[model samples]
Target: MALPLSVLLVSLLLLIAVPDIYATFHHGVHHAVGSRAHHRIVLPKHHRPKFKPGPWKQAHATFYEGGPGSFGGACGYDDVVREGYGLDSTAAVSNVLFNNGQACGACYEIKCINSPQFCKRGQQSLFVTATNQCPPNYYQSSDNGGWCNEPREHFDLAEPAFLKIAEYRGGIVPVQYRRVPCKKQGGIRFTITGNPYFNQVAVWNVGGAGDVVSLQVKGNKKLKWTPMKRSWGQKWETNAMLVGESLTFRVRASDGRYSTSWHIAPKNWQFGQTFEGKNFK
Candidate 1:
């Protein structure tokens, strides 16, 4: 019984010593010193190499897909866009984002490349529902908005690429527009796009968000749209006065992403005096 107990004790001791022995032999900590092992899987920094011309199509390339107002975060044409937003390993942001491990790369997925488009006239916004007809020979991703979501794993710069094309048409393109009904709360009842890709639209030259007494529109084949107006790429410039004094007029453009203030200015005007009717005694 004593011999068996001795064997059991020695086996337990060897098991405990194996890890230290390995560390001592390989880690240069000196076997007699019995120090901890160096244990970490060192990974090389992540990087994107510059591409050659042939495979470079998607390199700085972007494309569009999907119908009007049907963006489902799946990278499509009707998606929101901004220029100079992508991972360019040759650029500073990419270099910094990688070396420092910033979450900027994680916060917002590159929806789609803002590519270019060819509209004969500048793009226009509309009211009372206007359809954005894609140019001929151009087709959006017919199949999207499902589990095959927009590719966000990479630098998707398609929407901006599309906008660049439209910009080449001069000014900006109006994807969709809605009336912002002026309410007592001072916010206009503006239209929002059904597409998640596009996030905003705009309207200008109107009274208080609440002061908008009414709105109407007449459409033309030439433009996006305007309220009580009949043309695309054009707007109704009207004046609004508070109490017949202190006036202001503003202009705006909307494309479904958000409304933008084109311009604004105050006019010199005055309110008339109020009169109180009374009978003399």
Candidate 2:
């Protein structure tokens, strides 16, 4: 049966209107769901700030005679060799500050502030280097409580350095110290030690922003560079003897500075020999 024209037109209009109405409803629902999802997201909180290294710090200092025949210390360098190399009045710092030889070769300036009488007539401060570790368990026999066993920031100074700032009678003194850049006049010095079977190289006379951090060695015949391990103190060592006729060293300081010493050690280099290499500063 054929429907009337008016009824057919009305039916068509209703169909179009129904689709428009459904689209409007869907649009509204989509916006509502999107708004709710946006609200559910959370923002993270800010993190804590990092610590800044200070110029000056307070610490306890004690004087001790390294004594005769006292050579290498916990950092592993011979004290006699260190002194001969012009590192006068070296100090042994606590494990807290030593950082397990990471702080080796670092320099510090100390001033005695607690006792005025112990201070020298005109001397107000003394500068020392970190060459050894003051073990916490090790106690000084002379003093009942050792400086090493003291607080974290304790400094065990050699007798000479201690006397410069304080009198010998004052076994312990409160001091204010600061980390300072080492002032070296000449280029870096390389001290070679160990037996013929092994090669141990100690970097000394380093003058720059920070102490030595990494070392690499290359021989004349070797195509690739070999990284050296930090044996102790400022010393870097390799168990096997260098193969090539000439040896070169690449040194990297803690401050991220690098220096290469080309052929510093000769083929016939003997043990206990010292060589001066290019400067880092």
Specify the highest-lDDT model's number. Answer: 2
Q: Once superposed on the true structure, which residue ranges of model 2 sit more than 4 Å away at CA? A: 1-54, 67-72, 79-88, 120-122, 138-146, 195-197
- Best of the candidates, TM-score: 2
| Candidate 2: residue 133 Cα off by (Å) | 1.8
Clashes in predicted model 1: 49
Model 1: CA > 4 A from native: 1-134, 138-227, 237-264, 268-281
Quote the positional error of residue 131 for candidate 1 in Å.
14
Error of 1 at 129 (Å): 18
Per-prediction TM-score, please? 0.17, 0.70
| Candidate 2 whole-model C-alpha lDDT, 0 to 1 | 0.73
- lDDT by residue for model 2 (55-103), tens: 9998878866655225236665665444443334578888888886878
lDDT of 1 by residue, 77-181 (tens): 131121112322101111212122111111111212233344323433211111111122113341222211233112222343344324433332322111232
- Each model's C-alpha lDDT? 0.24, 0.73
As a whole number from 0 to 100, the lDDT of residue 216 in candidate 1 is 33
State the weakest 10-residue window (summed lDDT) of model 1.
272-281
